[model samples]
Target: DAGITQSPRHKVTETGTPVTLRCHQTENHRYMYWYRQDPGHGLRLIHYSYGVKDTDKGEVSDGYSVSRSKTEDFLLTLESATSSQTSVYFCAIRSAGGESRNEQYFGPGTRLTVT
Candidate 1:
């Protein structure tokens, strides 16, 4: 089975505020990424981490940030919530060992709404 997860299956917040979402993995993989899925466009990465405490921004990196302090956990934070940021977010991972690093697995998804 795929080894990835995300928190707050759903959330709603006001504009100009801050919000945080979480991702957790059971497998000890080395690559983790956070992406937002919106209508029309395909999944867009906001940030990713190659290892614990080593993170980098992704395609849609504005107004969002991420952190990974452990192999099993990653966090995404929005400095200020905006209507444009309202979308479903997904946490995904690329495994690092035992023939699990080539495929990409996604979390169920988190629906965030900024009003």
Candidate 2:
């Protein structure tokens, strides 16, 4: 399993304000992903990074942005926080190869509340 952690385990913010969440891993994995978990919707992908400075949008990319400047850190920013954006955000690292190639190790979630 990969070693991962997320910052600001819980947060409350006003609508339209900018919010940023951070994810860090110690395994030096090449693929990192951001996903939001909400009622009924399950975990939906927000963005992912393949390598340092190389990123891509995911299924739920609107209003969300991600960056990876180093192999150990990934950041997710909400340009404008909204009520609908309130959810538990998760950071995951995919195993590069081997038996667990498709397996993803997740970090403790960051719970965000938008008022």
Q: Which candidate is the best by lDDT?
A: 2
Candidate 1 per-residue lDDT, tens place, 32-102, comes to: 99999998998999999999999998999999988888889999999899999999999999965467537
Q: Report the Cα lDDT for candidate 2.
A: 0.95
TM-score of 2: 0.95
lDDT tens digits, residues 21-50, model 2? 999999889999999999999999999999
Which segments of model 2 are wrong by more than 4 Å?
98-100
lDDT of residue 47 for candidate 1: 95
Minimal lDDT window, size 10, model 1: 95-104
lDDT values of the candidates? 0.91, 0.95
